[model samples]
Target: MRELITKYKPVIKFIVLFLGAYLLLSVAYGGYLKVSSHYGYTPDFITDLVANQSSWLINAAGYKAQVIPHDAKPQMKLIVDGNYLANIIEGCNAMSIIVLFIAFVIAFAQKLKKTVLFILGGSLLIYIVNIVRIAILAIALYKYPEHQSILHSVVFPGIIYGMVFLLWMLWIKMIKKSAT
Candidate 1:
């Protein structure tokens, strides 16, 4: 057992750091969720906010968009030009992705200033991309409702995750440079 541990020490260290940081951040997020829930900030609040924000972007892009609130479900309707194109849910808000991004960045454990700045910048990028993704998806669904599954499941998710992958790569390069 000791020999095996010594042989894979670096891998073990990485796993420990990543899991520890992820768990800590996730627990803090859970606490935040609880506090928000206690204060009446339901999942619908986040969904509605993202839907309205996405609606603004869609409208600004020359389409008439509006958000329809739901009482029973934590979802909002994204209406574009009198057509219901998509339902905005809590998952659509990009908070979980931001949390994942922060956890990864924290795991990498850059300098204090660099880590904080990267998290802030990366979170903003993810949020903006999410809004744009929602807007573009709304437009695409309006034009070609036939390809709904591919667009929603493949293309949109690819864009967001692809961006995060790129960010992670860039962070790795930064870490390498700082280390050397």
Candidate 2:
């Protein structure tokens, strides 16, 4: 038993630490969801604000817009009309933190500096990408509603996973550079 324990100590330590962190984060997120749901506050807030301030976003993009709630859906819905196109936008507007968390964990595992600046920069980029993704998805839904399921289930996940892969690749490159 002692020999077996010694042989797997490092692996056991890694698993314990990873599981501990994962559990902590999961609990924290669950609390956040509970509070948000209880207060009726969520990404829906962003959708509401966007719908209410439709002109700012649309006019800035040089598009005429009209946003109205769709009775059938439990989310914010919008209709935008531009110079030559029209679109329907519906869904939550909050960035998915799961992807960001995964990225952070990957970086941490690679021993990247946990400096505030580094975290902030990475978080900002992730948030920006999420916004772009939501907007693009809205446009895609409007233009090709028939393919919504494929885009949502496959393409969107692929994009986020691709970002994760790129981040991992960057970590590998950094590791190689440091070793020299």
Q: Which one wins on lDDT? A: 1
Candidate 1 lDDT, 107-152, residue by residue in tens: 7876899999999999999999999999999999999999999999
| Model 2 lDDT per residue over 29-105, tens place | 55755565566543345455545454345445554455555565434445555322222332333234543455345
Q: Output the lDDT of residue 79, model 2.
A: 59
The TM-score, computed over Cα atoms with residue i paired to residue i, of candidate 1 is: 0.90
Q: Poorest 10 consecutive residues of model 2 by lDDT?
A: 82-91
- Against the hidden reference, what TM-scores do the models get? 0.90, 0.64
Whole-structure CA lDDT of model 1: 0.86
